[model samples]
Target: MEQWKKNLVVLWFGQFLVMAGMTMIIPFLSLYLQFDLGLTDQHEIGIWAGIIFAGNFVTSFIFQPIWGRLADRYGRKMMLLRSGFGMAVVMALMGFATTPWHLLLLRMLNGTISGFNPASIALISSTTPKNRMGFAMGTIQSGGIAGTILGPFIGGLLADTIGFRPIFYLTGAFLFAASLLALFIVKEPFDRAKAAAREQVSVLQGFRQLSGIRELTALFAVTFLIQFAMMSPMTLIPLYVQELHGTTENLAFFAGFVGSVTGLSNLVASPLLGRLSDRIGAERVLGCALLGAALAFIPQALAGTVWQLLAARFLLGVFLGGLIPAVNALIRKYTPDGMESRAYSFNTSTLSLGNMIGPITGGALSGWIGIQGLFILSGVLLLANAAWVWQSLLRKRPVRSKA
Candidate 1:
């Protein structure tokens, strides 16, 4: 097998492990706060849960570009290992937290060190053949989505069986194992001496240089909007499910299905769309996906039954699956050589920013507008974003794939 193929395979699993470990705590995060940390009030648990959940993304948004710069200067594999191992230790410490503050701080620290996913993207992007970039990005994305879909399920089960604290230790152990896998198996052909020879650019300078490109800047905004639109309705999905079902009976099961069904369909669509992007061009796929995603949201907003909402969300996933891989492929195509990591990092920063702000905004707005209204608003936002994508990307002839 080719070196790039080898790296892609290893990094795919590595991305899976990283995402799974990170999300494993999600199923019982509030439970941990209330029971283990002794937060008695439901209101207090809700507040603390919100803070703790957002904490990682808050610090991750600030630090991703810094690490991206370093990855460009040094190597992406090193950055990947650093994040994997660092997060391993921090996640383990969460198992030992004695207070809500301790858990919150640890979560923030985890965010501060989180770069494995972006680094993995940068690594695979740099190494993979340009013609296969779409497929590579899509395949790697599916791995993370697979992890995200499975993590909470496994976490929920383990929380009930082995208890919460040990799940942390188990997550940490899995992360450590993933890091070691990368250390031994993944090979990055980063030219450090050549990278060193290039004039060093500060993070701000790099950001400016990348943002100066109109398309790259537009791509960044697209990434932000994608996350923002998708994440905005995530926390409220259960309530919406309850509303649609008209009862709390089997609410957890129904909610879990609705929440994960999008990802399940997304998992199936990503690689298929990715190959299509490789043939037809990522820009076209991106624009069409955006439009399709926007249209899909309308049904979710209008659905009066749980089954209807589930079907709508699943359809939405098919388009949502195409967005990120196309964005990553386009980023690589447009980025100047030797700055790919930095470009990906900046995109990751925007992604984290959206993750951090989306839920808060969703929760805040849902009270005023209601869940159905939030869905309408999200669809409208995505329609506007689709227009932006059309103007910024599809208006230009897409770069042809190399023969």
Candidate 2:
């Protein structure tokens, strides 16, 4: 009913649709590369699929800060519209791809244009009340988590029923529809004068500004570590599931269930932990979640059965749910008022950086140290991260009180 609450509800759905659209191709990407694109060899399909997926992140990482600067200058709503519409068009063109190069180029372009999530986060952070910011962010996060959890399933169905190419068409259309809702419904209280004043600060100046804010600098590290910890064990999950469950009837279903359970629990827990953060403070919630996730990983590493691992993952999800929202809320709390968009964008880049590093480290080490070792390494990384957060927040206490 409230204005900020209204923004949350609309943007929640928009984030959901956008995330769903992006991930909808994950299930059948290799299939499309093989059948439709005529890549006959298994190794060739794997190589092209990795290239297509990694190409997006490579461009996305490079382009995010640029988009952040533009969002700060032009208004975050405009950035959101740019990403939404641009991505929609790019996605639709993928439906017509006749070669691997076509899909690869389109995906890279999509990444270069992709700032929808960060733009939405920046806009919502600026619009929401400071007290309720954690709650709002958590709720929005749940939408994306839910979408990520379900998109592959939906894409699989769409693939089965209508085939591969039409899946892209449907995803593109859904994206356009979500953007339409955002265009008409989501409102931001923009000030041209403020934007003009902000334009005076150059990009290097902005980075220097973040460096001067000790808490902001530390929080950025926390962001990267949180993502690294979450992603490190991800690539080994299917293998772990099979090891625990055995190759039985419906093995793929079990693998999918274990993969999704963490996100499902995240969907259930984010709003609750977010509200908790609002009451007790985001920093406290963040430290606790980091520690909780670390401990949860130990049980996961020790699990002898699929059900045990699933339970541990669900617990891990419950803690992991609290992290990004809390971190975002803290960023909003500490960042200079006019620089919120760029700050969040920088945070998103840290996320992308972690995405790149985590899986590589996990995969490389899994062979030498083994799959269980990756989980242990992740827990150690997270525990160290939790300590860093504790010290960082402690240092901020005196400065915050003086302010």
Q: How many clashing residue pairs appear in each of the predictions shown? A: 0, 0
Worst 10 residues of 2 by lDDT: 394-403
Question: Ten consecutive residues with minimal summed lDDT in candidate 1?
Answer: 394-403
Error of 2 at 184 (Å): 1.2
Q: Candidate 1, TM-score vs. the true structure? A: 0.97
* Candidate 1 per-residue lDDT over residues 105-145, each given as its tens digit: 99999989989999999999988888998999999999999
- The local lDDT score (0 to 100) that residue 179 gets in candidate 2 is 86
User: What lDDT score goes with residue 86 in model 1?
Assistant: 98
Listed in order, each prediction's TM-score against the native is 0.97, 0.96
List the global CA lDDT of all models. Answer: 0.89, 0.86
Q: Candidate 2: list runs displaced more than 4 Å.
A: 395-403
- The prediction achieving the highest lDDT against the true structure is 1
